[model samples]
Target: MNEIDPFKLFLELQLALPRNAPGSARATREAFSLLPALPPRPEIADLGCGQGAEAFELLRLANGRITAVDLFEPFLEKLAERAEREGVPETRLRVLRGDMNDLPFHDGEFDLIWSEGAIYLLGFEEGLRLWRRFLKPGGFAVLSELTWLTDAPSPEAAVFWEDAYPGMGSVASNGEAAARAGYRLIGRIVLPTEEWWQDYYMPMRAKLAGMRRTYGELPVFDEMEREICLFERHADEYGYVFYALRRD
Candidate 1:
């Protein structure tokens, strides 16, 4: 069996679905709601800005310049295309491909860091510590992470993410970790319910049906079909926790 490409799995899922990127509705609302009012012209970084969903949202909120960073070349390409289509200047939207775990930037480089459904790519606690250094004093980090509601997850869930996301933890534990990491808690919210799953899985299932017709049994089609099933099975129980953290 060819090893599954988890990143690709996420990419297809999101590209095929939603106005925002994947994950909980409540989480996106929470993160956006918690944003500190930008300066007259604040500089912001959208870490892991896959396909520029959150970046576009921030552009609306900040009305300021944005640097959208992602590791995937394809997503960055799409982001560039989006910039042109949306009439956002190439200069106004800067796209960079970089490692999230080892961010390449000087300390205090940005006023705000917008991360949605990405911190779990690295260990959540580890991201809390390392990414903090990138923020200026009193700078903000608005992020959403996969959070467990139950301290002990269902056996199926535990098994699912253990293979998928080993770093997953409950919202309370993550909040405690952020506090310990020296970030003042500005705000937090549990992701919204219906908008979360419908946004991704519903459209993805549609895409899979389309691909199945076009390709007539290709490997990619099969992979997406399986992913669609998984989402249908578990989306209700899984959710994200959104947090707005500030440097103390």
Candidate 2:
């Protein structure tokens, strides 16, 4: 028998899960409500659109065009399949596969740029600064990021995140970065704990159980199991926070 590639297993676990991270349509709508009025048929870009859950929600809310960008071709294909299943018009939804750090669109191309649970691929501040040029003047940019909610987190949680995401910052610090990046901060919300479990963790838990049965014990799977246990124990210390901003 061939040894299973752990990274491939990780990718397989993520396949078909709605929303790559902890988010809900309700949260998406709430963030959209905080934005200033958008033009009719506005042009929006969803950076790192995983399976396009948020992208579809945006389509429903804005009645506008969406350019869904992702580095993974499979993810883009999944989004395209979903768009077709929902009877979304081709003219309204476009999927482009490309690196988030190097987007293919020209400068000032979109009225709104949105990313959910994917901004940390570029450090939050760097992503804001780099992507700002792609937004039309006064256009909005919204993203969700992992944030340190409390000043004092448990040592274990701190160590785990420091190893996993050293650039994570407090909400106030992120707000400061937004301001420094030339965006007027419009709104910020901490996603509820239920959002984390319901869509992401719960399903991931089930998948992990099945994988363990198939693969027995492996270091990669052990690491993921530990991460989940840590999250369940330390949810209060950290969370995904959505930030809404408009270019000045």
Candidate 3:
């Protein structure tokens, strides 16, 4: 049996997010519904786009142009391929390999910026502050992030994210940080229960099974299986927070 790579385990978890599921597509659409009144055509950028799922949707709605950005090279390759296959024009779709901490675009370059479940990769507050300059005046930024409904998180969940995302914060705290960073909160949504976990976990358990068969004794698989169980146990304490913000 081959050894299970921890990085592979993490990738499996990320790929399983609800944003990638059919039911959760509505959430992504709902998040975009908060855009400012503008012309039918607008420029949009999807920050930390894993494989362009949300970016594709934005392109359809904006009827203008979309730029997808990510740090991972392979994911960007897949995104580009998907775009081409979808009949999106080479001119209309642009993919960039860049860091979200310091976006490569000039100030006020995009009319709308979309980030789905990716802010935790960078500290939430820092990402809000750092990426604000990239938005056009009155431009809106939409993001989905993990947050706690209660002030306190379970010990297990807290410990999990502490290592996975050291800079995460609660929804209230994240909202305050957005305000401090000069973004007006236009809207916010707390995800419902089934919308969050079932979309991701069902696919993930299958993947884990496949991995276990391929890599029999790998300890990483055991670790990931345990984490999934814990996430199930604490499903009600936290959720994905979708926020719409405009430059103040």
Candidate 4:
């Protein structure tokens, strides 16, 4: 048998049918409703959008253009296919391959900036500061980030997240960072545990199982399994918090 690239296998499995993150259409709606009613045809940017689980919902709720950007070509391809299947016009939902760290967009160009479970590619505070320039003065940015839900996390959960996200902050800390990043800390909505299991993990379990069958004991499999196991044990200790902010 030929050597299978574990990294490639990992990436392939990440396209787990529903979405690439722990988010749902309902959560997207809940987060968007927090923002003031957007102008007609509001220009939005969904940066680091993975197959656009949130973006698709946004399209259904708002009649606007969303520029969905992601680094992975496969993810972009999948998103385009989904958009096409859903009869979305190319102009309405523009897809592109790009880096989040250095995006090609004008300052004050967007009415809203959205990212879910992806901004961690850049540190939370760093991403808020960097991406704030892209939104109009009154524009809003909503992001779902992994955060410490409790001040006192169990040692097991604390050790895991500390290694995974050393800069993870509590809601209070992240809200403060949003203020420091030149935005008003508008609101927050912690994702329900159902979103984690139903939307994200349940979909991924089959993929991990497939990978395990194909390539036994790969590091990626172990890493992913560890995360799932950890979440099952300590879901209450930490979670993805949606932070809604508006540029000052």
- Candidate 4 weakest lDDT stretch, 10 residues: 10-19
Model 3, residue 168: what's the lDDT? 70
From the highest lDDT down, the ranking of the candidates is: 2, 4, 3, 1
lDDT of 3: 0.78
| Model 2, residue pairs in steric clash | none
Alpha-carbon local distance difference test for all models = 0.75, 0.91, 0.78, 0.89
* Model 3: ten consecutive residues of lowest lDDT: 14-23
Checking candidate 4 for backbone clashes, the offending pairs are none
Off by over 4 Å in 2: 1-3
- lDDT per residue for candidate 4 within 129-190, as digits (tens), equals 99988998899999999999999999998898888889999999998888888999788899
lDDT of 1 by residue, 206-230 (tens): 7777756744556766655664565
TM-score of 4: 0.96
* Clash totals, every prediction: 4, 0, 0, 0
Q: Tens digit of lDDT per residue, candidate 2, span 1-248?
A: 89888768877788847768899999999989889899998999999898899998998899789999998877888888888888988789988998989988888999999999999999999999989999999999999999999999999999999999999999999999999998999998899989988888888888888888988878987888888899899999999998999999
lDDT of 3 by residue, 71-162 (tens): 87767877888887888886788999998887878899888888988887786777888888888888888888887777678898888877
Worst 10 residues of 1 by lDDT: 19-28
Look at candidate 4 and tell me the lDDT of residue 178.
88
Q: Which rank order by TM-score, best down to worst?
A: 2, 4, 3, 1
